[model samples]
Target chain A: MKITILGCYAATPRSFTNPTSQVLEIKNHLFLIDCGEGTQVQLRRNKIKFSKIKHIFISHLHGDHFYGLVGLVSTFRLLNRENELHIYGPKGIKEIITLQLKLANSWTNFPLIFHELTSKQPELLFEDSKLSVSTLPLKHRVYTNGFLFKEKAGDRKLLIDKAEEYNIDFSLFKSLKKGKDVVSEDGKLIPNRLVTADPPPPKSYAFCSDTVFDLELVPMIKNTTVLYHESTFLEDQRELAFPTKHSTAKEAATIAKEAGVEKLILGHYSTRYENIELFRTEASDIFQNIILADDGEEITVE
Target chain B: MKITILGCYAATPRSFTNPTSQVLEIKNHLFLIDCGEGTQVQLRRNKIKFSKIKHIFISHLHGDHFYGLVGLVSTFRLLNRENELHIYGPKGIKEIITLQLKLANSWTNFPLIFHELTSKQPELLFEDSKLSVSTLPLKHRVYTNGFLFKEKAGDRKLLIDKAEEYNIDFSLFKSLKKGKDVVSEDGKLIPNRLVTADPPPPKSYAFCSDTVFDLELVPMIKNTTVLYHESTFLEDQRELAFPTKHSTAKEAATIAKEAGVEKLILGHYSTRYENIELFRTEASDIFQNIILADDGEEITVE
Candidate 1:
């Protein structure tokens, strides 16, 4: 899995900086997250194929998070996209989009699907043969949710040498890979473990953002391979984070540490700070493995 | 009056080229026209004070014309604007904006006034002591209107020497400036024209965009100081322009000639062309004075 940070700054989009938006590429899917204003232009600048974006996930209704949605939808129409587009966002998203389209009289010719989320608990959002996604409820000034994406466990790898020695037929190898015993031509049973090895462990990534310092998400995101969390402020401004329902670098690192994630990626820094090195420094003190998220940066999940 | 072209290109906002939007500075007022996507960023880059934009006029319901409006409005709220904001657009604009505000649950603390335009004919929209704005109906793919801003005729320059020579009291000076004959203290009538030179002729600017080449607007915008017309394509693409409800450079120049405007400013160039000099050359064939509007270019109205 690979993740590209199109934009990661908090609040308003500046001439040099952008707001929240990212592209998570898992398996065959290129999922867009939190489309802020000018996200389409960022996508163009980043050279991301617009048609590759089939699914979009919006965290909340904040203008900084989803203001670019309507424009993106219109752009898709202008590009003559015919594939279905799925949007998963907080409730009221459908109304906002529908009203804008109606006013413009430019509804998409392609099918635009909406999945309005209002659940307060962690609920499964999407699942396929390769990957599964679920929501992690977050505490913010408004209704918000973070996403957790995990690669599904695959079939065991068959030991070709052992299978040949056991006289296992090529057709029976499928059952052996499924951890099933295979019967030879002589009607003798061959144990699955003797002919196959366990497949590599599935990788998982969890995204957290626009939330206050709370440990409630730790259990849901435990043992994640890569954990991307919002670190809006530094440790010195922890007090200011409370009322705004934002997290400091130290707090985000604490969550990463408590969850036992392999690596912690920090982003969504407030524009008030001239530089974001302080966030990384503070987070690094708490969590040794830290990756700073920046626009145009791409991180590959191992 | 100063006109700042924040965005002048047509179609979607690209990485370098922006869509339609401009800032018209008339006296103390800063009026924004046709806010497309990424306009807020353009405003920030241009160093235009956000608070100074109290009134906004949207020409049509096309996404390129009005998509940036909601984001700008939300940005104003985030900036904690105390001044009232007045938006004038198509009839459905209010619903589109109000629904988004409701979905975000982000109501502005300041007053947000919406003036929805539905008139098919030209009508007055805004007026102050110094200037007035009216709509000039335009033909487009959707319901659209162009704006005409004219500086109200100023008071006649007070000639102190002539007033004193005519024994005109200070009280009559106001009447003389009003182009009224003043009765002197000697009971003799002093003609105001003889005492005072004519005030500078009122300057007018007409803005027309997203419209086809129609001669009906000639009488309305006749003999204007500066006329801005959309030149989305060059003469080579004139055949394509009619179906798209857009004008070519030659067509826009023709309108300027028929209107007898002093200066013609051409904008809204389609992104398909690599160079815009061809547009200037094509327009110059019909009109002598042509100003090509580019992003960040400012034209002073005399």
Candidate 2:
């Protein structure tokens, strides 16, 4: 799995810094998350194919999070896209987008589907053969949700030498990979474990942003392969976190520690600080495995 | 008068090219015109102060022309701007912006004023002591208006030498500048014309964009100092102009020639053409004083 950070700064977009937006590539899907202002231009700069994005997940309705959505939808129409676009966002998202389209009188020729989210509970959003996605309720100034993406385990691996030593017929190889017992050519039953080994463990990633420090999220994101959490401020500005519904770097690291995530990626830094290294320095005290997200940075999950 | 081309392209914004947005600095006022996507960043790149902008004029509701308005407004709120923001656009602009703010729960601390335009005739939109703005109706796929920014004729210039020669008292200098007859110290009446000259012929700039070639604009923008007109296509692609409700370079030149404008600025060129000089070449046959607008180019009207 690969993740690209198109923008991760907080507040307004600047000449060198952008707002919050990212692309998560898992399996065969490219999911766009939290499209902020100038996101389309960021997508172009990052060289991400606009046509490949089919699903978009918005964390909230903040300008830094979802202001670019209408422009992206309009550009898709201008590009003459024919593929269906699915948008999962807050409940009022549809009205905001549709009103702009109506006023402009430029509706998309392709299917534009909107799934307005309002539930406050964890619920499955998408599931296919290889991957599944669900929502993690977040505490913020507005109604918000974080997404969890997980890869499903594949079929067991076959041991060719062991199968042949057991005199297993080649025709039963498929059945053996499916974890089933097979009758060999000699009419002797062979157990599945003897011929095949277990598949690799499934990998999962959790994305959380613009939320206050809450222990409730630890249980939902526990043991994640990678966790991306917002760290809007440092320990020096811890007093601003609760009132603004944002998290400090130490607070994010505490959540990562409690959740036991393998790697914690910190983002959504307020633009007030001149140095971003302070975030990592503060977060490392609680969680040793810390990654600071910058615009145009790409990370790979093993 | 100075005009900065923040973005002067048609259709969607690209990595290097931006959509339609510009700033006209005239008579101590910065008037933003047609805010497209990425305009706020463009403003930052141009080093223009955001606080100086008090009025924004939108030509239409097309995404490329007005998508950045909401983000700009939201940024003003984030910056804690105390000045009132006035937006002039099509009839539905208020609903579109208000809906987004409502959905995001981000109401501006400063007053947000909207002047919705629905007229097909020329109408005054703004007026001050030094300048006045009026609408120039244009033909397009949707309801559209071109803006005409005209400098109000200033108080007649007082020739200091001429006033001294006329023996006018120092206390009567203001009256002489105001073009009123003043009594000299010898009790002789001095005619205003003898002591004053016309203030540099009230420079004007007309911004016409996203519209087809319309002869009716000639009367509205007649004898303007500078004219910025949309030339979306060259003569080679002239066939696409009428159908798309856009103008060719030659057509824009024709309008400039007919309107008797001092200088013609050709912009909003379709991105399909690799060479923009071809637009100037095609237009020069009809209009000699032609300026091709590129992003970040600044023009001074004299």
C-alpha lDDT values of all predictions: 0.92, 0.94
Off by over 4 Å in 1: A158-173, A181-191, B158-175, B181-190
The residue-by-residue lDDT of candidate 1 on B1-302, one tens digit each, is 89999899988898998999999999799999999999999999999999998899999999898888888998888899999999999899999888888777789889999999999899999999999999999999889999999999899998899889889999887888889997899999888987888889999999999899999989999999999999999988878899999999999999999999999999999998989888899999999999999999999976
Backbone clashes in model 1: 0
TM-score of each: 0.94, 0.99
lDDT (10s digit) by residue, model 2, range A137-201: 99999999999999998889999999999999899899988899999878899999999999888
**Which residue pairs show backbone clashes in model 2?**
none
RMSD score of candidate 1 (Å): 2.3
The TM-score between candidate 1 and the true structure equals 0.94
lDDT of 2 by residue, B1-302 (tens): 99999999898889999999999999999999999988999999999999999999999999999999999999999999999999999999999999889888889999999999999999999999998999999999999999999998889998999899989889998988888998999999899999999988999999999899999899999999999999999989989999989999999999999999999999999999889999999999999999999999999976
- lDDT for B140 in candidate 2 is 95
Runs in model 2 with CA error above 4 Å?
A: none
Which 10-residue span in candidate 1 chain B carries the lowest summed lDDT? B97-106
